[model samples]
Target: MKDSAVAPTRVDGYAELRDYAVIGDGRSVALIACDGAVDWLSWPDLDSPTLFAAVLDQARGGRFDLRPKVPYTAARRYLPGTNVLETTFTTASGTVRVTDALTLSDTASLTPGRELVRRIEGLAGSVPMGWSVQPRFTYGAHAPHLTRRAGVPVATYGAEAVAICAWHAGQPQCTTDSVTARFRTEVGTRALIALPYAYQEPLVLPTHAECEARLDHTAAAWRQWSDERTYTGPWREAVLRSALALKLLVFAPSGAVAAAATCSLPEELGGERNWDYRFSWIRDSAFTLDAFLKLGCAPEATSYLWWLMHASQLTHPRLHVLYRLSGGTRAPERTLPLSGYRGSSPVRVGNAAAGQLQLDTYGELLQTAWLYTTAGHRLDADVARRLAEIADFICTTWRQLDAGIWEVRSAPEHFTQSKMMCWITLDRALDLAVRQLIPARHADRWHEERQAVADFVETRCFSERMNSYVRSAGSDDVDASLLLGLLHGYRPSDDRRMSGTVSAVEKTLRQGPYVNRYLGPDGLSGSEGAFLACSFWLAEALARCGRTEEAVSLMDQLVALGNDVGLYGEEIDPASGAFLGNLPQGLTHLALISAACAIGEAAR
Candidate 1:
């Protein structure tokens, strides 16, 4: 092996949003560009401040770079049935394979500390590879001090420390801010790099062989987890990949599923729609429960239910739309000082939507509770009582104006989707009560309110002009969320009204093959990209409405829209086919899985 130090090559601008793949260790996730740059990472935990923020602001944000010194064409994929990412770089002279993963322990559990492992193997002639390891703490707000511990590079920022160890034939040149290494490898040679983070603790460097073994175990664990999934249907690969992505969003300690790994990745480029999604949203609990339950993962549902129960206790069973992973409610929204992702200014840290009164959350929470009980998971007395109280709250407060399901910042309105969900809240609660899943304290009252909500939606929300259900009372605008009426049984897919609503949505909200949330003003200045999840919802609606061929075609298009590694962002630009918003979005994966499952069921 030949060793030398090379000056780091600066990344000129941001990589395309779709050009990154994600790897995680249950606790945190990292986004790696196709060019082998680990650009965005939040270590120790998913919601923690970024340790590497290069993906957001390429010029000032920090990153870890690893790639060939010469020009190369790249192809990447996740190892089958696992989240281990493998990228093959082929140059005119040689080819190399890079494997990336967050290391797991022997039992296939997240390692006690933050550990990222990268392995490279030469497949052809000799190739020169360059790597730079730089640490920027606290979302690039803190510059760490670098030192060597037992010959390994250590980066310390206040109480947090990360140690980097390498196993190769090349020596690394280390500075106070970064470590750079360049090496030439021949056929059959391999190299390894490991970085582990600890909070105010001495670094324990793992041997290269030990790190390699850990990688093998981690892959095995992921494969075993994937193998347990019961979705052996059409688009099994897509479904499994989505399931893996959703699993990555699960913060194992608390079982709170984050909305996405990275915050402030913009829904529209150069727009203010950037918002942090590292926290769990109560509104997502129903969709997440449906996805996980369908994929044969009951433990996640149980854990989530426990978290919900515990979190409800904090606020006296009054649920908010979102909460921190640790069950804290104070996620004050604030803009960071750094320039946003690709000049999308005002990078927001916490989500202000947490305080919004989205009445749909009552329906979502009750629906999740119903799902939990139906899945053979027993709810304790306290949990049952808390759920009952939630339903009671919905009964009394369903008529209040709310921010609706979309969490619009505008004045409250009687959104049709929210009304339908209020109906679902009572409907699911009544169903569970009938089965003695919980005490039917207000069954009669819930029944009356459920019917009242249905009547209100039918009489007030439907528009004869649009020949379909509208976004709100007295409004003629169709929302993509109306597609969810089919899933929630608010309307039969074959009903003429449902058919009309579907047609209206297609006419108004559909843009080519994608679907926007709504065409109306959302109280935001710039327009948002097509919501990927809503597009999936449209596919599901089509499948349920007996348009099998059209649904399959649409589903195929939506599935193919995913990035190379089968991950999707929150939104997509319809014309450019560029991913937008926070990436590897849980809602997108959940919707994809749900739509595929619907299509599979329809086919059968």
Candidate 2:
């Protein structure tokens, strides 16, 4: 790393989305920029309002900063097989290493409700270090009440409190909105900082020794989890990293997997294309279950399927596009007044698409149930009956115009991919019925509707001139999501129609490894970068089509697209290589793992 100023450059006080690395303790996540600023963090739960919304509004939003006080260069990476981040800062005077982690609980010690640990070590000459913690609660809507608690600087708001603990750091100067400190480090010197948080409970003041032990134990725990994964594939490292990122998005209390770690981190910069992704989506159910099982995450798979069944029970036969991580059905869309990341205005909180009539979610949910049962997990009588009813519901639902997987805001249309997924939904349910996993009473009706869906897709959804499955009936636009239908067994990979659609996707939607989701209007202003997950789906489609070499080549390019720490955002600006959506996006990582697994299986 080349020498630079003490602080990393920012776009109007905001770090670029690509510059972030995340560390989480399975409940909540924090996005730490390369410059050692924790810019985004949601307390208590992944879907909760953020304590630090700096990524959305740098001013008024709060953050934690820890770095050398003088000019320096920094290089960072996750310690191998761990979510713990080790950032090495090299200054003219000396070198220092900082390890950042959201510590996990240990059986041997009394752990805090939540803890963020930062450990620093000096290896060369003296280097001055500075640190600060600015706490803003409720999406930066409230400035924290700063006070002292048992000699430690504490910030509290309502029922939540966070204690800042420091050792060998300068006296923390309490300000109206933050706590600031500075100190110098000598050779062989060790210093530590810990943030212990409590929600509706007493704050835990941890000793330095306890923090150190927790940090060490957290790293070990993550390493052990990584070691337990069974993905010894061609892109093992990327696959494992994707798995780790996905695991962080899984809510530990409930098995719901959040779509991304953050909310409203723009799909298009300075545009009205931002939507909150902190909720779990039925759209990703199939991929989530497939990825968890393929990576040997049996426990997560079981928990997630159970969560899915229980959460969807609220709507029963009619599934919503997304659900709250806590399994609540009400995600009332709202906006915050804060300036968005780089002036992407109207930073959003909840997703309005939950009420959309997406015909594809049924397919994804049924596909998930089918995957679970096929993987040897049993479904109870009620779940089986519910699955059969969902299949019966899809029998009629597939014929209606609805929002497709893209969840476009435009008028609903007969999206070909949605119809294909509808077919998968019934097809999977029918197979489960045959296997005696689900009630077979509606088997004949499901079969008839499945055939109707197939006929509709083949007749109206396919383009004769374009030689591909169109985005919607009577429209010539090609969608990258069509690849998903093929991967999910809408048809054999070698089927002429499926192969034609794959080639059409490459010719129309793909700009090398970067693939646009579609080239049509969505009733939204501004354009977004390439959808990263679609590209992974393309690679997997190729592998499943028996084009192993092409799949491997494409997979290599997509893997290389990730940032230095092997993390991906929701979208990428293909022209500038800038990450354009939420960082550490779970769907993108899920696609990566699924693609890697498919390519590896095809090669074998």
Candidate 3:
């Protein structure tokens, strides 16, 4: 809700991550900077090549700019319970309000496959406004061929097209790679702009009336979805906002929730720790399924589990660390030529962690299935067979080193979290067999191996001097991820070892509400900010341990950490309070939801 009259503060032409809010239409999302620029958007789908990525490269990445020509300070918020954002600008001349949304499709008209609608209204004296559309295709690698469809300006690249339909605004004049316009608004004036997009199909050049109706309908639809949410807990506002943010990351067509909206957002300024988080991770499975069921998103919960099984069939019984939104297995890491956000170079597109051997994934998947079945959802015969086989696979695979939950690039090691999750995998498998959800012929072997895994974790992972479980087999350092060992029932909250581990994590890895992933080397050259998800995990662990007052105090601070629009990024710089990674981060929101629910339950 802040920006100076001239502009939002920018360093090297990049707005602060916290100064951005996101809007989406299930299929795609747009990152609109506080100063009113749509800086990042991947068209047609969440994981597709960018149509606007100024967040990645200021000079080459395209954007849609809209703001008052005269200097104006701005304040913004989501329009009630909806994702639609309303921004108000106050200049000396007058005040103006703008509504922004990636409009949802409607059956009342020939709606677009994808559409971004912006509405502007003048409330006081005259205010001059300006807008421009700079269309760059294929991650800013291709300049679109600009033309006109009937009276509207159109940008085309191969089979993809975008037609700009505007009314009561200025005449759009096309330049080489952009279209610009200028206009003035008096009291009670209204204007609208719509970008109707097409992919491998004919463009839908929407009418002004249809665009206006669609915008209204989209807002109503969002409100309806929000009203249906069942979470009636403390911090309901933040929890619901996180749920909306999570919805944006869900690829609606496939039911796979993406890890984040944009890619290559740096974990540290001018650092090589930048990564692409567009794919869904196996580690988020348990929490995602849990949150969906808790929020009464039953359809999403079912599709998510079905999507998980369907996507991993290609690599059956062996889960990749992550999978593409469309259920694809491969994500070959590649870099773009453009300079990254704020000069963080090698802007990457794909995730290399997809190929890593993360033993924690097996436990996460099995836990998800267990949760699903416990919620009264049935696993079919085929999926039941695969779950049993995966448990069997873990029996032998748990002995190998793994990249672990954080996906560290360092040489694989026997991470303590990975070993604990291996134990969870077999324990859940034996439970499923006892429930007769899966075959019990191999239950005896699973039980024996589960004990072996438990023995290894208890004896080797616990540090006698530290009175806590170490990050790896023998190290004394504490890791924030160790908190999951308690959350997932690896150990009860009353267990002295678990309590000591929580204490060690707080002592070694926390400063106030901020929590570092680990203090040790991650095999990367540059350091990263505190992981936001870990901080939320600590809040949940505290609540589970019956430290309700402390949990509430910590959560109060953490909830305030969200930016004005109640959105969180992947990480935060504790020293500066600057968001440090890809925005609308799924894991951070998932952790927030999980923490809020746990704390609410404990307080009750």
**Candidate with maximal lDDT:** 3
lDDT of 3 by residue, 467-575 (tens): 9999998888788989999999899999999999999999999999999999978899889999999999999999999999999999999999998889999999998
* lDDT of model 2, residue 538: 94
Clashing pairs in 1: none
lDDT-based ranking, best first? 3, 2, 1
lDDT for model 1? 0.86
By TM-score rank, best first, the candidates go 3, 2, 1
Stretch of 10 with least lDDT, candidate 3: 1-10
Lowest summed lDDT over 10 consecutive residues: which window, candidate 2?
1-10
For model 2, residues 407-443, the per-residue Cα lDDT tens digits are 8898999989899999999999999989999989879
RMSD of each: 3.6, 1.7, 1.3
At residue 561, what lDDT does model 3 achieve? 94
For residues 1-604, what per-residue lDDT tens digits would candidate 1 score against the true structure? 0112222233357888888899998999999988899999897789998889998877667899999999887888888999999888888789888999997778443443778999999999988999998889999887779888888888888879888788893687888688889987789999998888887666667778778999888899999999999988888888999999999999999999999999999888889999999999887888899888999998887888888778768886567888898888989999888888888978999989988988888888888888877778888888777777888888889889999888998899999999888888889889988998888978999899889999999999998877899999888788988877778777788898999999998988887779999987878889888999998899899899998888899998888888877899999998899899998999999999989999989989
* RMSD, candidate 3, Å: 1.3
What is each predicted model's overall lDDT from 0 to 1?
A: 0.86, 0.91, 0.92
TM-score of each: 0.96, 0.98, 0.99
Q: Return whichever of 1 and 2 wins on TM-score.
A: 2
